[model samples]
Target: MDLELKGKVAIVTGASQGIGKAAALRLAAEGARVVIAARGRELLDRVAQEIRAAGGSVAAVPADVSRAEDCARLVAEAVKAFGRLDILVNNAGTSATGAFESVTDELWQADFELKLFAAIRLARLALPHMNRQGGGRIVNITNIGAKQPRAKSMPTTVTRAAGLAFTKALSKEFAPQQILVNSICIGSVRAGQHEAKAAKAGVALEQYYANLAKDIPLGRVGRAEEVANAIAFLASGAASFITGSSINLDGGASAVL
Candidate 1:
């Protein structure tokens, strides 16, 4: 099916690896001119080169989204490179899981800065461009823990809850302008953190993933590409009517409806 994404311009944060990198590749494959952002210069450039090698139009911008100035610069560079921005995928974040008492003020502040505030700042910066262009899409990559928090999940859950609220609020405020805003609440997707855990456990990578699947109803962890597919759809014309909604990309692991 045609996503109607050809010639569209997209900016995907955390694009150096994992779900962000996967989403960037998918958008470019669907014919969007993609601007990939991450703090790691070499890895970000490598992703861009891979996209270009596949005959996709892409550029890599190294930026730490946790900084407000970096967020502004990233958006500016994308606009300068593409002339217009059609999609903003706010996928830059790290998991900050801990017990409530273990999560100090510093951890909470840092988590909010990177996950919640970064999305807020980027959306604020990009909304005018979308408004001027008549419409756009914003996809926030959150986690199911936002809706179904566990006992020990502290800073991450709190911040992701804020992200969920942000997505809904933006969707309502911008829908009249045809600017759709949505979020994908991911579960146990294969990412760098999971890979590192597997290595540290001295377990085979595949076995570690299999162990993770034991708790999931689907009996498997999600792939980065699978999450990317969801993000691409949300950013495409096919999802024109979808807004203010948070879809769980988990493998039925989340108990909440």
Candidate 2:
């Protein structure tokens, strides 16, 4: 079924690779004019080129979302390029994991800056435009750890929990304006980070991924495209009634309800 997203404009952060790249491609494929953002120019350009090659409308913008100025610039550039912003996907973040004692205040601050504050800043910038347009969608790519924290999960878990709260609060505040907000809580997905970890462990990428899936109920890790599909759905008219909800795209890996 069509998502009825044609002509809509979307800004996807951290679109250089992983779930962000997949979400950008999915949005473009659904006929949304997409502005893809990341800190790396080369990979961002490559993703944009790939989308263009597939006849998808996409533009690459390099920005570090942790910076307030960069967040404002990203939204401005998207409006300048596409004339309006209908979707904002806050997917740019780092997985800073460590024991509580090992995580420094700097690490905690950095995690909140990128994962929480970026989304907060972008939403603050985009909400008025969305209100003016009569409606819009914001999808925050958080993780299942936000809902179910394990041992040794520091800054990431704390910051992601904040993100979950942010998602809910925004959903409530904007519903009156028809601005829907939600989150996709992720689990283990096959992405660039996993590849790096595999290489670091001196194991084949496939083996590393297999090890990751052993504990998941599905017997395998999820694909980036799988997460992207959920992102697109939340940003589409198809999810008109889905505000204030956190959908766990973890293939049943999350133990909490």
Candidate 3:
């Protein structure tokens, strides 16, 4: 049960809410010094407070990972606060799904910047620090759509597919140095976006979730904490040998896996 995370330092992006928030809390619970990042300053601060209330060491850095400078700044801020970086969770992204024709050039550019480029830049920045420490973990938060692409799921699926490839390539290049890389392929987890969509449709939240579960074999949508459990495990010392792999956290919803 010991994740062996005490005294480690981790940076989690898109960490203001949902899966990101859950991952931050889980890492802090395991006694890791956590740096939480998101575009929303208020929500980011709240998460930091919750971690502190739980007696966890944490720093909140509000950054839009889609921007190159922000990604660099996030890394610098974390190292400045903690003196070293041991884990990097590239979780800052939104699910932008739609018909190919309906997807604008602007949307494509934005998706690549947020989901793909950000991860690239952060890993590039975090690698040297990990090298100094001798080893580290980079847990990319991708999703099942990366492997099981469906109709009308253009940019999101495409972006995530790149993430899977990135995870493998990075892991292979860094394994000799003991810098393990992996990804958590998420499923239909209950998130802030789903809550907003349910409210907009005037459907009760539970009913909305019930409708979503109709197609899932597990008969329920996944919780953020469920995904966080895997994130924490992958980032911990216990997962020392795991690299260049993607764990599907879909509860039997993903057919390809």
TM-scores of all predicted structures? 0.98, 0.98, 0.98
Worst 10 residues of 1 by lDDT: 94-103
lDDT tens per residue, model 1, 126-232: 99999999999999999999999999998899899999999999999999999999999999999998888889889999999999899999999999999999999
**Pairing residues by index, what is the TM-score of model 3?**
0.98
Flag the better candidate by lDDT, 2 or 3: 3
Candidate 1 Cα lDDT to native = 0.95
Give the per-residue Cα lDDT of candidate 1 at 17.
96
User: What is the alpha-carbon lDDT for the whole of candidate 2?
Assistant: 0.94
Global Cα RMSD, each model: 0.9, 0.7, 0.8
Scored by CA lDDT, what does every candidate get? 0.95, 0.94, 0.95
lDDT of 3 at 131: 96
Query: Alpha carbon lDDT of residue 123, candidate 3?
Result: 98
Model 2 clash tally, residue pairs: 0
* CA lDDT, candidate 1, residue 164: 96
lDDT of 2 by residue, 1-257 (tens): 88989999999999999999999999999999999999999999999999999999987899999999999999999999988999999999867899889999899899999999999999999998899999999999998999998999988998999999999999999999999999999999999888888888899999998898988999999999999999999999899999999999888999987
